[model samples]
Structures are given as structure tokens and as C-alpha cells.
Target: MRKWFIERAPDRDVLLKSRWLAPVASRLAPATIWQFNRRSIARGLALGLFVGFILPIGQIILAVLFAASIRANILIASAATLITNPLTFPPIYYAAYRTGTFLLDLVGGARAAQTIAAAQPTGIWTSLSATSLSTFVGLLVFATLSSILAFAAVHLAWRVSLIWRWRRRGGTDRAVTRPTIHQEPPSV
Candidate 1:
């Protein structure tokens, strides 16, 4: 798992030489960003989801920047941004728009969406309306709630897994190792 995070994060050597990352280079150089711990992983995953959901583009860079500032796992944050890729983009946006519209209505200021069809349909980008404000609001709300939920979920799951592992190890705090296949020497 640590190796997985290491492979995703930017190398320390590369950070010192990159012009784009120069501003945050010194901060990211420390092993803190690469630490495979609970808080970092949780923060990284939550930060990545928040940035990815809130913005359609620049998710990876934004995740990295936020992770660096917040002391989250840089690589995990970067990888988590993939949650909002091409395949999942449209549906997620549409859902966010709907959520926003619903929330706005509940706020007692329902903005009636007027769709003046311009020789084309808006598809599922909205709730059958032309209201970008609602979508934006929904995105903001969605991002916040999602990130919070993700953070809690990660922490809870981490604790549960640890307990499960400890129990499986005969109620002891021992690292379980998988058995390796024994290879017999060939007769010369």
C-alpha cells in the first residue's frame, strides 16, 4: 500500500527541478507527503474528492497543491482526483445540478429555469432548466459533503481494519505474512 502511494507521488528529485512546483517544492520535499499513515491518507482522499468534484479541470494539480498545504498524502490525493474523469464526468455534473436545484428550492428562492432551446438540447447537464447558479451551488455543497463523508469513512474503515487484522492474528498485534512457495533445487 505504501509502495502504491510512493509510485503515484512526484519524486523528491523531480520536485526540486520542476518550475511549476517551485512554489510548493520546499514544503513537499519532506517525507511527510509520502508518509503512509491514517490522517494523511484520509486527508488526501478527501481533498482529492473535494477538488475533483468542485472543478472539472486541473483536479490533479489542485489536489496536489491542497494536499501539500494540508499535509495530506500527495500521491493519494493526486490519484483520487481520477474520480472525476471523462467517463464519470457527465453523470456527476448532472447529479450535482439536480442536487443544487433541489437545495435552492428548499431555500424558498426557487429559480425557475428557463430553457430557450438553441437548436440543441442541454441533455442531462441540468434539471431540465437553464440555471448554472443552482449547479454551482450544488457542486459546492456536494463537494463539501462528499469530502466530509469520505474523511469519516476512511478513518472509520482504517480503525475497523486494524481491529480485524489484530483479531485475526490471534488477538495480538502481529503483522501477518503470506506464505511463499518453496522452490526445490534442481539436481545437477
Candidate 2:
């Protein structure tokens, strides 16, 4: 096995020297961004699109984190979030509400039952119209929970895929191997 750490030029030495701050600097500092692997970028884009369509917030963050961990360009990952931009907010929110309602029924059936009964007189049409407090709260709760779930799914997906890829590439000699932290190079 061979590992090499390229020494940064003197003008950019401070950024390259601070072990703790180097990673952050790499992310936030401006530089001539480069693409690592086209295949990985394509896979990431597809994943980001699916996530944005189904799970916006969590998907956005997960995509960013995933790219960051792999030392991919953060700008591209950040752009992927546009998949769920303002244009699609309403529909996404609506779907999130329905999903949340389903989850609420499963986990807190009794509470949901009570809320439904108490808010029944508001009428089904009126309830989902965003006028009633219960409806609003339900929607909010559903979006939050769904977002959480989506994030969990993203995390699991990244871990599983990364592990599988590593093993397939013949990197599984150890039963357990900690993931590496990918950092960008300091700009000259």
C-alpha cells in the first residue's frame, strides 16, 4: 500500500499546516474546483434527485455530507439540493403531511385517534385545508419526522454503498475499518 500527502506551496502553507482547521478551510475556501470521478458524480446526482423528490431537507444535507466525505466538490453537492427548490415546495410539503399522518397512526395511534375525533367536526376537506391548528401541527410533525427518517435512510445508504464498494475493491482485509475523512487540497 502506498500513501502520499502532497506538500502545499509556502504561500498556502497555513491552510495546509493546521490539521484541525485544514478540512474546514478546504470546504469553505475558494479554489479551482475539480471533479473526482464522473461515475461517482453521476451516481450522486441520481441519488440527490431521488432524495429531493422524496425527502428534501435531509436529502440536501446528506448529499452535501456524502460528497464532502469523499472529497468531492461541495459546490456540486450543494447544487443538488436545487432538485427540491422553491418550485416544488408545496407538493413536497403535502406529501410529507400525508406520510406524517400515516406514521402518526402507526406510532402514536391513540393520540392521533384523539386528535382526529376532537378535530372531526372541522370536516375532512376543511381539516386538510391548513385552517385548523391540528392539521397544521400534523403537517409539521409529519414533515419533521419524515425528514428525520429520510436522513437516517441517506446515512445508511452511504455507509452500505461505501462499505460494499471498498470490499469489492479488495479493501476488506480488516473486519472493521473506520471510514476516512476526505479533505480538499489547499488552494495556491
TM-score per candidate, chains pooled: 0.73, 0.36
Candidate 1: tens digits of C-alpha lDDT, residues 1-188: 65665676666787678998788778778778778889999999999989988888888988887898998988889888888888998888888888887887887445445334343565755434456777788889978988999999989998998888878876443334433368455579
Candidate 1: C-alpha RMSD to true structure equals 10.5
Clashing pairs in 2: none
All models: lDDT?
0.80, 0.52
Model 2, residue 168: distance off in Å is: 27
- The prediction achieving the highest lDDT against the true structure is 1
Q: What lDDT tens digits, residue by residue, belong to model 2 across residues 13-55? A: 4544678656556653433222333334444454445445545
Among all candidates shown, the one with the greatest TM-score: 1
How far in Å is the alpha carbon of 49 misplaced in model 1?
Answer: 0.7
TM-score of 1: 0.73
Off by over 4 Å in 1: 1-10, 14-20, 112-130, 172-188
TM-score quality measure for candidate 2: 0.36
